[model samples]
Target: AGVDDGSRLRLRGEGEAGPPGSQPGDLYIFIRVAPDEIFQRQEYDVYCRLNLSFSQAALGADIEVPLLNNESKIIKVKAATQSGEMMRITGAGIPHVRGNGRGDQIIQMMVETPKKLNKKQKAIFQELAEIEGNPIKETLKGFFQKLKR
Candidate 1:
């Protein structure tokens, strides 16, 4: 009786007629889009998670992002990209069943933390950490110092 997310469509005289000369009934159609593993739909928008390596995130990269139509798009990752930040790709999402407009794709970034690093990798990371100087504390040190006053 009611429509779902998309625009409602009413087809006049598309249904069976009541009598030989009586007015025909109207056909109401609704579209239901199924859930996808790679993308989650919210209304018409699509959202997906994307993981990036430490180097890829810090150095920036352009990777192929998959879309709903069996297509992939090149998404640009800015340098120093952080986890939990969202990027948007316009018009790359599911199209409205009744309208000509298409939704946008939202990409949630996840910067993978290094785990079980090899001997060489551990050494390099340790050296880099030392050079970076307590990334979190260094950033908050000045702010925390203000709290003392």
Candidate 2:
């Protein structure tokens, strides 16, 4: 029940029979743990990714994350959360291989931008762009300055 990948078990005299007067060889078995579809393990730590809509990321929301079992937990994503951010849940990962405590679960946040917009959506975005001015122009200016240096 406590076994993990790479664990070996040796069975004495469980191999093929040898000569009449000699002892049989031992049988060694290696353990191989199959990969789970959702979670990825590193040592005792587990990791997964969560996708967030642009509005959800900008306005904050409570999202559900899956556990090792068939359960889930809700985590709060703070407002203005950026893409590629990481959220860690302490003691929510896999149990230690041979210890009393468990590890942590790390979730990577991915913010998705819409690919297609309706007429009203496009109008709203254009208004926002107007209010925000031209960020691309400022970014390009910074890039050119860096290149000149």
TM-score of each: 0.67, 0.77
Question: lDDT values of the candidates?
Answer: 0.83, 0.87
Indicate the residue-level lDDT of 142 in model 2.
86
- Clashing residue pair totals per candidate (backbone < 3 A): 0, 0
Candidate 2 local lDDT, 25-107, one digit each (tens): 99999999898888888878889999998888999999998987688999999999999999999988878766599889999
Q: Give the alpha carbon lDDT tens digit for every residue of 32-145 in model 1.
A: 656568988776788999999998899999988898888898989999999999999988876787868888999999999877889898777877887888432355678898
Among these predictions, the greatest TM-score belongs to 2
Candidate 2 residues lying further than 4 Å off, grouped into runs, are 1-7, 135-149
Error of model 1, residue 85, in angstroms = 1.0
- Report the error of model 1 at residue 35, Å: 3.2
Candidate 1 lDDT (Cα, 0 to 1):
0.83
